[model samples]
Target: DIEIHVHPFALSYCSHGYRPQEVLPFTGSMGPFFNVFCATIVSLSLWRIRNPKLLPLLMWAGTAYIAEGVAMFIDIAGLPILTDWGKVIIIGGVSPVIIGILGIIFVTIGSIFMLLLMPLENVSHRDSFGKKYLITTSISFYFLLSVIYTSIFVLFVLDNRLIAFFSSIVFSLLLTTIYNPIFPFLDRLSHTKTFQIGWSEVKIALGSAFGIVIIVLVFF
Candidate 1:
């Protein structure tokens, strides 16, 4: 059974002198969370492609961002941002509730950045390194923060310093190595509209979705 495998893994973890102060909480309604993300992405992509005019682009962009921002706040509002607003009551909504909101916002912001980098009908200085550098910075920051969070999570869950540090360093380095050189290369491909939100874009989206699926399948 899967529990048998997980049990030894848990026991081996305890034997290694790692333990959690408290078991991590369960996430509720994961399916809805996934639905929101996929639907939101699809909506935003459709909005982008359908808007031949700039006004339509801005309208949809603003609407999407506001929707995503509201979603993120639903989770984060209780995490010290605005607990008094009664968001943390926990009577409703999904697990890692904050992640539900945050993940979508990340995608939303990512879409906005893409729009900025390649405005609907203009080609001024977007090809310049100066412009793309900002986008690069945003992405690198996400990678770095993600690695740090992973490290803390590893330490908390598995309770093995060696494994935690090893994984963190190795993973962070790998991400950096691949990420550092990938931006400008990706930026170059943006000259053509066909590849704008095509293969490369889908690769990132599907990779994220697949990762979530793997995690849920492996864990709770």
Candidate 2:
């Protein structure tokens, strides 16, 4: 039952226009692949955090990103149990509930870490945006992406687009506030041309791939 409700909204979104069983393959494949990508992002952020050249704020941002990625991945990784039994590779007797609990732990720790790393003293506008402003913007953008996905789930799966839109606004506000403090660490990190260019490319590539996957599922 945990699996049934894990990403109930997401599953609903992807299953639109198809029988429940029909969408399992698409959801199953997409879920794990996206989660693996999250794991990669977490690893990369942690690696960036280890670089001494980066400022303390940037390192904190990396740590927060890692927490966010890990939390999402943990939840997504549990999908195989229900979607594809043949691929259900349990980890030392761990259950879906246990993994969900672990994800919650990561979220709590990440939220606290961001709060601790807030550069309240450095509120001046060193970059195009002030520290707090940058953090708020970054969190808002990320939350918006999340809202898009959740809204799709609610709209298609739950057949309540109106409620989904309103709920997404509230969810985005809450999540953005939760991570607002730690985003300024990016100001220092973004100074590197290599990082800026590379990150932009990475985002574009991932976004394109995600769109392609969705189109494939919906039309084919």
Candidate 3:
């Protein structure tokens, strides 16, 4: 049900005009180093901050670093990138063109929702409608970004366009339904005393994992 224009890069690269294989060696080598450098800066900056909200950003960074590291290694091994799994998700790699339009819609919707619904800094307190709104918007944007990136990765791998669009609609609607109901309960749970204690534990674990990610990226 969606229409998309394939990026010009796909067309330009088809004739071995600019072989991705040539760049893969360099990118596969340097990407992790760059990620490690960035992670180091983030880890240092985070030590001076007390706001727990930044944990999500750190986790996202760590996740991408790990994923890129895997993808790069796979590329080095002459294998398809791990990030290209979106093709697998799109009905067994048959019709993949819809991902581009889906990406555009997701990003546009997410950005608009974030601009309108993201809360003020002091809206962190429990039982506030602003807090719930912020959580909903954040979760929505996270999923949208995840899907967009994966779809782009698949495009990079497959380089095929002019495929069916309707196949992905049901999956998107299902995800919408699943995420919408959970946020209300998540908001309620956050206000409980037990949740506070559990949250602290989770925060500590995330902090530890963030540090470990930085160490791994820097060293290995």
Candidate 4:
């Protein structure tokens, strides 16, 4: 007999010939652990050895990776909570509630650190860098926002996670190209101190907002 099982998190159904007697091992947790570990190492390495002139770029890259890792961890750990309606829960023999709490703490700290670091790095290095850096940074932030929005939308609508992930990435890249025409305006605006400072702050704020949105989506 074909047994139909609905996945609460994915909001999709699958079929199996027979119910397995043994509990299947969840290998999903490994991806987040790997992401966190690699990102931490890369961030630390960039801070220690990267050129001072590239401070803003390095800081942005480092913080982005760290945030991504933390987001992934929260998403994976929170899946069980969505499936079962209970305050007390366990997944893979560990309490995902605890993992979710820790993920929140890490995200909070990381966001605050990024908020402080982005503006300071931009202001400090403004004189050394040129219009290229400013334009690049602006476009990078825009691209990131596009990716996040697209990924979330696609993941919700599509049943296949891998296909949704890659499709979002491709579509995000196409969407970001729409901003190419504004590059000239951004380059001109880069000459002003006020605009630079304001842009830096805005970018960091949006970044933090996206992180929070991801966490909320995963949990709720």
Candidate 5:
């Protein structure tokens, strides 16, 4: 399972020592929704790697995605920079820990893959796949976030709509800004097409595990 440790801030606000499940249980409504939601987000992040052309738009939209993921991750674990190794730097590149060890690996591999497929220049012939995928995926992310955010707004009206909305905004900004600097380093790794071959299969395996978790959560 995805073990999460909560932030200290939550402890001050809520009377309990922070725990992942208490803050965001992956069962009931959140189970199925997050299952579908994170899968889409993962697919979106893998954009340029899958089709070299779509890098621009996918990266543009990834800004928001990186924010959402990081924001929630922070709300859970505070500054994840405290993770093992503190920080990692290399002769050729660097990786800032955005969430945890897994996050570092995900972005690292993604950057390598995307960088491999990077265009030598702004070549026009390579634009078709990029444009088509971006349009389709961005629209999908928007649709899902829109419905999810709006529902959170309406359903939680009795409690704290303001925090919820602000949380969404923070999430948007966090996802975008966090990934921008990291991409270049990943590019430097120079593992584009080959990275995708391994990463995609891993994604499929992880996704299967996620689906089973969701099913178990919902039923058991």
Candidate 6:
């Protein structure tokens, strides 16, 4: 469960306040344009780059940005439906909050993992066992990160500041314990060939999806 606090003035247009209906449209209209602009610059920069080492980091950043933009649009689309529904529904209907949180989590964790694995991209050659190990390790890491982050988010949403603080400390300890052993194994696996090639394919797919998103947002 999560609680969101919106300023009263944000809902209604006060003399000095913003209104959602007006503001959302303006921001929504600009969001894709801004993303496209940034992406174009990034694409051009990548094209001109001579170094192969920088590719992973650049691609990771671009993909993460595109993912975040897509997630934002998802949340935006869900907002009106959420207002109509008047409450959160997990099973039967869409929940903007849950969806949004999920998007954030995926983008954050995926980007972090990509960064962690970037150094291994050049050295590792894809193999059957390596791919399986990569997939399993990725899933496990993602689940752990989700739990740690979501627990903190829930505590804050529940307005349990004190508990959240303590939980953060506990989670940090737990994370260190889990991460220390796994990292060495991950590093070894990375040298033997991880899923870097697969990531390239995924990046291409995401780029195509982003283009489609832009088309939809602009025309429909």
Q: By TM-score, who's the top model here?
A: 4
Relative to the true structure, how large is the alpha-carbon lDDT of every model? 0.41, 0.42, 0.38, 0.44, 0.38, 0.42
Kindly state the number of residue pairs that clash in model 6: 1
- Report the Cα lDDT for candidate 6: 0.42
lDDT of 3 by residue, 2-62 (tens): 2222331232112323343323223322444565567546744663452444544443343
* Local error of candidate 5 at residue 139 (angstroms): 11
Worst 10 residues of 4 by lDDT: 82-91
Better of 1 and 4 by lDDT: 4
lDDT (10s digit) by residue, model 1, range 75-134? 464464322122322433334555555656754554443443333323233355444344
In candidate 4, position 24 carries an lDDT of: 39
| Candidate 4: segments with Cα more than 4 A from true spot | 1-26, 49-90, 124-220
Clash count for each candidate, listed in order shown: 2, 1, 0, 0, 10, 1
Clashes of 4: 0
What C-alpha lDDT does candidate 4 achieve relative to the native structure?
A: 0.44
Candidate 2 per-residue C-alpha lDDT over 119-203 given as tens digits, one digit per residue, 9 for 90 to 100: 4223323343334445534444444554577565555433333343454345335545544344455445432222222454446
Best by lDDT: 4
The candidate with the higher TM-score, 1 or 4, is 4
Weakest 10 consecutive residues of candidate 1 by summed lDDT: 4-13
**Model 3, runs deviating above 4 Å:** 1-28, 48-50, 76-144, 148-220
Model 5 lDDT per residue over 154-215, tens place:
44432333453455444434433433355466555533432233455446544664565456
For residues 92-191, write the lDDT of model 4, one tens digit per residue: 5556656567666665444433322333344332333343234325434544554564457645544344443454345334323432454344435332
lDDT of 3 at 144: 49
**TM of each candidate vs. truth:** 0.29, 0.33, 0.29, 0.38, 0.28, 0.33
